[model samples]
Every structure is written in structure tokens, then in C-alpha cells.
Target: MTSSAIIQNIPCTLVTGFLGAGKTTIINQLLATKPADVRWALLINEFGRIGIDGALLKGRQNDVEKPNTIAIREVSGGCICCTSQLPLQIALTRLLSEHRPQRLIIEPTGLAHPHELVKQLSAPHWQTSLSMQSVITVLSGLQWQQEKYRSHEGFQAHVQAADVVIINRYEQLDATCQQDLLTWIGTLNAQASIIWAAPNDASSELTVAQLSMQLNQPSASISKQRATQSSQSRISLTLPNHLLTNMPNAGNSAAMTMDDEPPYRYHDEQQGMLLAGWRLPSHWMFAADELQQWLLQLPNWQRIKGVVHTSDGWQQLNFTPDSLTITTTSAQIDSRIEVILLANTDNSHINSKVSKNERQPLIDWDVYDHELMALLAK
Candidate 1:
């Protein structure tokens, strides 16, 4: 709890995790459970233009008067660490200058690098204004087993860069799997404090008794010994295969201007939209056992998800870009998996690929399930 000598403001918590690892869920819970005496300001960064997360938090603040206890600022267009860091600084300046909330909670996009983001926030200028209280990373259980995601750079970085690692979906893992995960985590980041957290838990089991080992001290001391600039990487936007296909020039899914809202409202006309997706027909059916087997066997794919159609109905499958998650949801009946990818790639490449229809997958679409399975196996 070191306070800055120049500024008397409290430090902020930078909550980061890969996509859908439950960063928002934990933040929402923390906000709900925090003492009423403390006020909070939420800053959410998203990859796309649509600020859905901000809308969600605002919806929950219905009872608060306009300009009250909680305030949310949405930074869109690119990952927070990518193009939005300066904007984040500006926002923090305004918040500190005006509102001066007790706590500043920043939820970076799932793909953001915590070390890099923290470096920016802890700059000499911002030091007086804000300090980092913690850097928490969340992980999904099944991701390690998925070959496609096993060695994923982002997922590995997420685990490696954490001060604390929170394992989500703990209830879904078997005892042996859980133990194996713990062993694997120990080998990866021995210094990180690992805690198993479920969505329903009111209090994370990270009590003083559970944290007796004091795993993160060495990492902290080591970090203090090094210069901050040593940790940052050269930032750039490299679109994955899925995003390349949605470029305005790519195919049927061209970038449409915001005014042209017929097909679907895209964030930018210059950068239509890129969705990591897979389409399956309704005729295909997998029983519970079959589904579990398929999920366990699927290759690693981060932000890997698609709509799945089965004899029973339509459903959605979601996973981390590192292949950590293999979850099925019946909430959407279309049975196709479509994850929204960001429009942060170079505009030139996007336009070229979209206009030329050159981004089509090499695999045939007739028997997509088998073709997909074969592709993933590679």
C-alpha cells in the first residue's frame, strides 16, 4: 500500500485476462461486494467499436443518479495497450482531476499484455496520479489440453505475466485434471499465487490462510531490480486468418459504412468486421458424451468459437485463443460459433483481401465438421 509522494490518490487495480476468462465477472463481483464508503471508476477497453461492456456496466448502475458513484469509460477500436494507452492516460487524468474516485478499476481487453500495460500506467508522470495495486490474470481449465492452444503465445504470456492467476470454471474440472493443472501451473509461473474461483463463489477462497506460501514476492523483487522498459514489446496489429477474411474487399462480408446498416452494423466501413466463426448444420447431433469427447480432443484455438447446429437444436462453442476453453452454450439457437475479432489490422491488407475474395479457407465447406476436425488436428 505504498502511496505516491506527490499525489495522495490510491493505486488502481489492472484486471487483465485472455478473452472470456471472466475478468469482467470478477470485477463485477468485486464492485458489488466492496464497501459502500469507497467509490469506483470503471474503464473498459474493447477491440471493436461497439462498447458492449460499458453498456453492461451502465445498465447495472440504473439506481445511481446521473454522474454518481460508478462511471464507465469505453475505449474502442484497438486493444488498450495497442492504440488506446494515451487515451487511457487522458481519461485517468480527467477522472483524477474531476471525480477523484476511491478506486480506479481498469479492465483491459482479454488479449492485452499486462506487463506492457502496467509499464505504461506506472510511467514517471502517472506515478503521482495512479499506482498499480495488482495485476490479476484468469485462466480456463480445459485450455492446456487443447493442442491448438497449448503453446499459444498470448495464453502463455497471460500466465507468465500475472501477479495472481485466477482459475475460472473450477467446478467443471475433475479432481485429477485440477491437480494436473496445478502441477502445470507450478512449472509455468511458480511465483504467481494460484486460486480456484467459480462464478457463484461470493468470496474467493484466497484467504490469508490460503495465501500463507507467499508465492509472488520473488517476482516482485525481481521486477523492482529491472528497468520497466525492458518488459515492453514492439506493438503491432496482425490479423488472424478469421479477421483477414472479413475485410471489406474480402467477400460477401465487406466493410459497410455506419450509415449503411442493412446487413449488419459494423464498427467501421473501412474495417467492416472480422468474426472468428464456424458454421455447422442442424442435422449433425452429438450426445453429451460425444460432445465432451469432441471438446477434449479439439485442437488449440484461442478466441475459437462458432455456431453449432445439432439434431437437438442450435448452440454455440467458445474457447480461448490459446485453446484453454471448450464450452457449449444453448442460449443462441443458430448453432454456429461466431466470435467477434477486432478491426485493428492494417486497413490496406483488409481492403485487398476483402475486395479480392482471396481469404476463403482452403478446406471445402460441404462436410465442414469433418473438414474442421481434420484441420484442427494439424
Candidate 2:
């Protein structure tokens, strides 16, 4: 195809899922298997300001010398659907104009609503210029069984808007659980093609033909109005100063860079949720058993996700009100954790039960830090 033709009709695919559903894992697989002849651009969004996902995708330690074929842009501190929409558009436009990539892949923050993004791309201005491909939503098999996810409106919106639903970590489910998951997904989105696959294994099933599937429903008109409405929220956290002072440097100096900046304090929100996150040195390894025990006693956070350095190896942690899954995975840019909390709910009951003015803490950060220090000392 000629340059003008390619620029006018570049195929863009949107990959979305709830927090820690392995969307990045799928994206990485697709990139690894991409045709050598086809150039691609990647746009990643994160809820926190530190941009861990971007760093990981760009290959942090060698970011300066990374290849130029795959253009990457990250919009951090908020969802692309709301506060960062303008930035997203500018970055996307610039990426396309400069890189002239044949394919574009977008990984929106897990908390984002798909309808808003679809509406943006389907608008009159971009309708003729960009060819929107199948909107893929990844689901965790374990998370599907949880009532919290089943009842969430944002989660339902993602399912309803997707053209292809890929369920990751299905290997963890039994025959009965697998059947129930498929049944539930069908009830919510009968038009979408549902595929069962493991993380990093989706590329085999998500072939070019499968990704070319067209949307069954028209973009909803209400999404434009919803996009303008703000659901801003905030999370307040207190971490021990001693933990930051004593952490060691990462073992692999060439693999990643440990950020010295303090934890982010952003206030923007998405889907009625707010995030509080911390970036820890990669050398700060957690005791596996103690970490799991602490997670069990974690307070009422709506969602939690991070890549941690454990005594055994690197592990990915995914947590929700009803489920928590920890599986060994490769090391990321750093050891970091982000907790998402519901901001619009009343905390009167929690405060009264705990103390007259004390609110329910998300996690005992001080205790966690102390435990980590002791673990590293041994």
C-alpha cells in the first residue's frame, strides 16, 4: 500500500480489561509475534503518575537505545477516557503522522470505560481516517467468579462494548467453573466472540482474521455526554520513611532503573475509583508466605495490582474484593503496588466501627514495610 493509503486507513486495536487481567501480557505477545514487515505503534495508559507500564514496555534500562520502529506514548495519572483525552489525541495524532505505522495498539487503563474510547475514535473527524478493529477485553478466570466484578457497572460496560472477549488464566479453572464463566459472558454479550486462552498465549488465537471482526452495534451516543462527566476521587496513604531510606539497589543494573521519586499523589479518578500507588526499589524482596498472609488481611480496596520481587522469584499480584491471585512472572521496571478504592461511597459505618474519627485503612503500610525490612535482613 502507498503511504497516503496506509495513513488514511491504519488499523487500530483496543485491548482493555480490569486491573491485572493480563492485558499487557497479551500486548507483549502480539508485539513479539508481529510480522517483521509491518510497523506498529503502541499507546499505553496507567492510573498512576510514575508510568511503570510504559517503562516496562520500552525496556527501561536501554530505553535510550531502544528501536525506533515501534513508537510508544504513555498517558499517566488518569484514564484516557477522562482527564487525559486531549493528551491521548495529541500523542496519537503525532505518533501516526511521524511514524506512519501500519498498525496501532491501545492498552487503556483497566479502570477505563470502553464506550468513551470507542466514541472518541468513531467521531466524525476520525471515522474516515482510522479503521477501528475488534475491541478486545481480557478477563481473568478467577475474577469472573467474584460477585464484585459481576456486579460492577464499569466491568459490564467493557463486556458490552467488546467485539472479542478473551479469558486469560482459564487454565486455573475447573470444568464446571469454566462452563459457568462462558455462560455468564454469553448472557452479557451474545454477539462477542469469546475465546479461552492463557496469558501470553492469546496471540495464537487472536490472528489477523479474528482481529478484523467488525463491531455488531453502533457506537452509543450517550458516551459523549458520559465522557464529560467527572467521577474524580482521591486516595490518601502514609508510608514509613525508614523503608525508603534502607532499600537496596536492583541486582540487574542493566535490566531496570529504580525511581528515586516519592510515591505519586495524583487526585484524578476514573469509573468512580481513585488510586494510591508506591514505587519500591527492585532489590526489596518480599517473603512469599508473609506477603500472602498480609494480603489476606488487607482492608477493603476495590482493586490492587503490582509486580513484586519475592524470595522465590518475581510474582504478579492481582487482588479484588472477592479474589486474590499471585503467580510467578518476569521482573518489571520496579517493585510497585497500586490500590484502587471506591471514592463515592459513604464511610460512616467503617469509621464508627473502627473509631470516632478513624477511617478504614487500605493496608498497614508501616507494618508491611517493617516486615519487608526484617525479611531482607535475614
Candidate 3:
């Protein structure tokens, strides 16, 4: 493909899932097994203001063969399917125009509504240039059993939009639970191709061959929108670069330098969810064990993920109700963490998703900030 030639019919895949569903891990696996001759571009939309997934991906790429062939961009602070659609358009167009990649993979923030996004992506503008393939949604079978997830509209839509569904970590459950979960999924979308996979042991994910099998199925993404639209007033999104990938981060946020900048924090609330993210200066190091304990015990939240500089070295932390995994990492940059919690949370110290006057109390963010800083290495 010549640089001057127009790019069209790029094979595009969207990986949709709920928080902590291991979307990044699966993407990393796909990257490892991607065709050596094909140039692939990845766009990750993050729910938190401080972007960490892009950094995590770039960090792990050191182990990918011919990793230079991959192009990565991120849009953070809002879901790309809605509030940040403009940013998505800008980033997508630029990536295709500049990279002319043979394949495109988009990871929409887990909280986003897939039905609306599919409509927008299949709009007249992108219909001809990009060929939409399978929409893959990942979820643990345990999640399906929880009433909180089963009743959630975003979670349900993700399953409905998927051409292929991956029910990972289901082996951890007993036979009865697994059967009930599978039955529930069938009722939601009887047409989806379901694959059962073993739990990922932190370092690995669904094989490329398995992913390709799913992608081969043509997508029948939900075309009708169901969820209530967020306030159309656009939310600001930040696209940051913590990688030395030769490409610059888009001018999307205030944190200009990852190494030297002081800790930057941003908070956002949408769709009855509250998200917060932080970026600490690179020099700040924490006691790994202590930090892990503190993060795991965070008062009340749905999920927390971070890549940080620890006395034990750079570590990546992923925590959910069912599992907690921490592993060493090769990529280094400003240490950062992101947390997600339900909007009507009972945590008195945290803010709920409500208007200025209706908010419970001026959340004493200082308290949490102090708690985190206290774990810093002496």
C-alpha cells in the first residue's frame, strides 16, 4: 500500500465488554499473533480521564514481534460512542489517513452503549471506507449471575450487539452456575456465537486463532438505540501519549508531560457511574505491598486498575470482586490508577453522580489523595 493512495475497506473489529472483562489482555494476544506483514492500528477509548490502557498496551508491545507495525491512539475521559464521538472521529480519520493500516481495532470504553456506537460507525461516512467485522463482547460467566450486571442496560446491550461472545473464566464456577449463565445469555441473543475459554493467567489471553474464528462471523450488531442519551453537552476528552512510539499524543488534555508533571486528577460522572483517574510524577515510587493492600481495600468501588512505579519495580494492578492480579511490567512512565464505582454509592467520602447542588458533600478528595501519597516510598 503506497502512502499516497487512499485507504478503504479496512477490516475493522470492535471489542466490547464491561469493566475488568480483560479486553486489553485479549487485544495484546491478538497483537502477538497478528499477521507479520499487516499494519494494524488500535484506538482505545477509556472511561477514566487519565488514560492508562494505551500506556499499558505500549508497555507490553516490547514483547510483540515487529511491534513497530502497530499504531495506537487513545481517547479518554468519556465514552467514544457518545460524549466523545467527535474525538473518535478525529482520531479515527487521522489514524487511517496517516498509518493506512490494513486492519483497525477499536476498544470502546466498557461503559459505552454499543447500539448507538454501531449506528454512528456504520453511518454513510465510514460505511464504504471500513468493513465492519464481528463485534466481540467479553464477560465472565460469574458476571451474568449477578443481578447488578444482568439488570444493567449497558451490560445487556453489549451482549446483544456482539456477533461473538466470549464467556471466559466460567470454569471457576460450578456446573449449575455455568448452565444458568449460558441459559441467560441465550435468551438475550440466541444468534451470537458463544465460546467458552479458560481463565487468563495474567500473562496470556484468548489465542489469535480463536479470535480469528470469531471475527470470521459477520456482525449483526444491534442497529436500534435503546439506552437514554447522555446530556449532549460534550465532555472534554484527553488523548495522552506515554509511549515513545514516534507519534505524538493529541492535544486532548492538560497533562502535557508524563515524567515531570505533578500528579494530575480528573473526575467524571455519566450513566450512573463515577470514575476517577490519577497520574503521579514518574519519580514518585510506592511500597508495592502496601499500595496493593490499600487499593484492594478501597472503601467501595466496582473496579480499580493501575500501572505504577513501585519499590519492587513497575507493576500493573487489576482488581475486581472475583479476582486481583498484579504483575511486573517493562513499560515505564508516570504512575497512574483509575477507579470506577456505581453512581448511587454508599461511600460517604466520595461524590455521587449528581448535579452541583444535589451532590452529597464536597467530596474530601484530599482525604483519598493523602491516603495514596502516604504510601509513597521514603
Compared with the true structure, all predictions reach lDDT values of 0.52, 0.64, 0.73
**Residue 366 C-alpha lDDT in model 3:** 57
Error of 1 at 20 (Å): 1.3
Which residues of candidate 2, in runs, are more than 4 Å off? 1-6, 60-66, 171-183, 198-272, 279-297, 301-303, 307-336, 342-378
How displaced is residue 203 in candidate 2, in Å? Answer: 6.5
Off by over 4 Å in 1: 1-7, 64-67, 198-226, 230-264, 267-338, 341-378
Cα lDDT for residue 26, model 2? 66
> Which stretch of 10 consecutive residues in model 1 shows the poorest summed lDDT?
230-239
Arrange candidates by TM-score, descending: 3, 2, 1
Clashing pairs in 2: none
Please state the error at residue 51 of candidate 2 in Å. 1.8
Instruction: Write down the TM-score of every candidate.
Output: 0.59, 0.67, 0.82
User: Could you tell me the C-alpha RMSD of candidate 2 in Å?
Assistant: 7.0
Q: What is the per-residue lDDT of model 1 for residues 27-123, given as tens digits with 9 covering 90 to 100?
A: 7655654456666788888654434445445655554453376867777546667564677776666666565677777788766666667667656
lDDT, candidate 2, 1-378, per-residue tens? 223443686777888898767676667666765665667888888877657656655654244554555878888777778665577777677777778887888898888877877777766556555667778888877677778778888778778777778777767778998888878888888777776654444456554334334222232332333345343333232234544445544223223322344322333445656565656556667787776665555445666766778887988776765457777777765676666766444432223234456343223334444443454423
Order of candidates by lDDT, top first?
3, 2, 1
* Pairs clashing within candidate 3: none
lDDT, residue 363, model 3: 45
Candidate 2: worst-modelled 10 consecutive residues by lDDT: 214-223
